[model samples]
Target: MSAADADTVLFIPGLWIHSDSWAPWAALYEKAGYTAIVEGWPGQAATPAETRRNPAPLDGVGLEAITEHYARLILQLPAVPVVIGHSFGGVVAQKLLARGLASRAVAVDPGPIKGVTKLPFAQIRSALPVVKSKKNRSTTVALTRKQFRFGFGNALPKSESDALFSRWAIPGPGRPLFEATEAKKTDKSPAQIDTRLADRGPLLIIGGGKDHTVPEVVTRQEFELYDTPAITDYKVFADRGHSLVFDSNWKQIADYTLSWVAAHRVNA
Candidate 1:
């Protein structure tokens, strides 16, 4: 397809993650004939050194700010892109879809949004250290081995999980975690991803069977909220966790996503 005709693919990372985290996946999308773009949150640069050296807290950063930043970037793309988002980014993808930004979206273990009534113990515990502090707005929380094992590595081998922890793990903003905690109570939290714009495009929700942070049950439950008849799909990786996109089998996941886009894109 011509440059103008070929579809674009944008990869948005989760909280405290940098664009480099999606480098492998971006190459995969490029090989599949899709232009790829990786975006970060406002004031959130996609670099491990910067993220680690001066990790910022999530205070004052609300969902509206996030949505607007991504929306403006999406509007600048030449072609409507297929957004593939992980964790908090998945929530952002849902919100973008609601506003008609993309032709389709893939929410891989998206973070809790408004009205999601369930909060797993593991998730709460992983977030306790930061949320307990009232001045946590400026604090950063690093994922310890235990925290990663329970929330993101229950199904992976220790070596693999350990490597991931050492390589990509960094401090994440605490505000979103705190906001997501109260997402069920108020609509103002940063986790409020409105999948209500279900008709704007097709959506695929991928669940990590062992993901304590975003358990399969909750992922499955959230799928039902996309009430539109716009061809929503769901899948669960039995041995996967929150790090599904970064796993060794990521190629398979990427292939599946590319196939879905080819089948449902605007120019398909």
Candidate 2:
């Protein structure tokens, strides 16, 4: 098909990772005859450097705000598009799918939602910087090099991990982390996704074997939660960590996503 007539794919980035990190993925999608829309969260600056210089705009941005922002973006498009997201972005992606706003979705190492009860130690440790205190709920939290290594780059070499941190890391709102970590506690949590929609579009949940933030078990639970008869699939990168989407081997995951979407023949 001509690029002009091809499907659309919207890329969403997680915490501490800049929207620019999706540039390579967007290039790949555009080359594959897809309309690629890559944008930062509601309060994120135009670039990572700009966001780091003044992250005040990102403070107090919560899951509800993030989810609604994407909802509006999708509504403005000609048709519902394929949504791909990692980390907290993944959480919002699933919520979009639940609302029947996406043609298809791929959630990579998505954060814990309302029904998920699995709280692994590493997951707790990875979120401690933001979730440890209520004071952080209304502020933006920066990831230290050390914390980034543990949460996003455990499978990568120290040099590459450091370089990735230097290039893409930015302060992210703490409200989402607080909402995710304390999801089950809320009576009507915004982190909940209705995974039982029988007529919903296809979904593929990817998990990284060494991901500290959202472990393999967490992704597995998320996939299983979809009792719907609609297509729901799960894949794992056995040696990767949470940084799989932007790390050196990002093409592997991107190519896999393209192939999956082609094979399923999901609609726009």
Candidate 3:
């Protein structure tokens, strides 16, 4: 099909990142024959300067709030569109799906939601820098070199990591991490969605084998727990890390997702 006949593609970013940072990927999706839309959370300031000057509440925001924001955005679409999300955005995608929002979805290393039982040690440590400090309850922290080395840099070079830190790194809200960590205790658990939304639509869980934050093992288990008849596909990139979207291998991953949507998503 031509671009004119394709459904729009809405790209949702993970925590600590902005929608503008996704411009390149949006272009790629456009080239693949879809009109692309990149959006941010209500409180997500545009620049680091803005974020520093007016930092928002980290612990105050809840899942329902984020879900509502995306739901509103989804409603503005011409029709139900393919949703692609990463990390915390992945959790948001799950929330959208539970509400029967997306035509299809690609969740890359989605963070655990409530009711998810497996929390890897690496994932915990990657998040400990924020949750460990009481003073950090309302704060956001940039990933340190050491932490990135462990969580996101295992498969990338120091040069690339440094460049990404300079270009893409932003202060992420601590609230979602805290909430997702304590998701098991919450009523809107991952299990609740997994159980209730068994046949909402197709879901593809993409994992990076070298991702320490959402380790491949943890992602695998999360997939198995949640995958139902609606989920029609899955894949793991052996050498990729958590920052798969910007990684050199991202085109292949994006292409795979585009192909999946082409095969499954019905045009309006």
Candidate 4:
């Protein structure tokens, strides 16, 4: 499709992996006549290998900083793009919508935002590795293979889970987690969502039924927060986990998101 006719879809990745995490999704979006751009957090290395080898690049990064980086990128787009984000990137997508930056947004297994009080035991346990350390706020931390298996890859077979961990797992900034944990106490926390905004574009929240990180409970709570359910939608992929984007059934979710965007394209 020509640039003028093509819709831009910006893919925002969450913790651990960089922009490359969205490579497969980008290709799919492009095949559907959308111009896809996979962007990373500020200071994120180009690849998982590079970030694994040197994590200092992500030190001291926080949620607000990452949000600002993405907001700036959205402002530079030719038109308001369809912003799709996974994990913490999902949180950023909502922030962008609050700023009137996206034509539409899809948040998959999104990290919790302020006012989302339902923190399940699984979610807390999954985040313990990062939140356990106060110094992690200023450092980069990598999850152990076992931790990755439990928190992100539990729904997949051992071989596939191991392969995904090897290919995509990398050090992630801890400050974002810290920021999320303290969001309730902080005014204007980055995790705060402006659910009351009437002009905020349509949003779709996708959840994994078996997800240990951002479980269905969390996604449901997020969905209920929207004052206008007409523009907000939620779906759960049963048998999937936090790593749904990298799972074999990822295309199913992608196809749904594409259809949702197509349905709402007239607004763009």
Per residue, candidate 3 scores C-alpha lDDT tens digits across 1-268 of 1212236777888876666766777998888768898877657777755764575643345556677788888787656667788887877776676666887778888887655677778888888878897566466666776676667666788888776666666667677777777676767543245534665767888888889888888777767776456655669988888878866567878888878778776434
Error of 4 at 148 (Å): 0.2
How big is the RMSD of model 1? 2.9
Q: Who wins the TM-score comparison?
A: 2
Candidate 4, residues 1-268, lDDT tens digits: the string is 1122128899998888667868889999999888999999988888888888888978989888998998888777777788999999999998887777787889999999998888899999999999998999999989999999999999999888888899889899999899889988999887898898876778899999999988899999988888864488888888889999876778888888989888866342
Best by lDDT: 2
Evaluate all candidate structures by whole-model CA lDDT and list the values in order: 0.75, 0.89, 0.72, 0.86
Order of candidate numbers by TM-score, starting with the best:
2, 4, 1, 3
- Which portions of model 4 miss their true places by more than 4 Å? 1-6
Please, what's the RMSD in Å of model 3? 3.3
- lDDT, candidate 3, residue 100? 66
Quote the positional error of residue 167 for candidate 2 in Å.
0.5
**Model 2 lDDT on a 0 to 1 scale:** 0.89
For every candidate, C-alpha RMSD to the true structure in Å: 2.9, 2.5, 3.3, 2.4
- lDDT of candidate 1 over 1-268, digit per residue (tens): 1223236788987864565778888998898887889877776645776767766634355556677888888777776678889988888888877767877889998887777777777667656766888566555666778777667767789888887777677777676777777777774566666655535777888888878778887788888776676778998887777878886777777888878878876643
User: What TM-score, over all chains together, does every model reach?
Assistant: 0.89, 0.96, 0.89, 0.95
- Clash counts per candidate, in order, are 0, 0, 3, 0
Q: Judge candidate 1 at residue 161 and give its lDDT.
A: 81
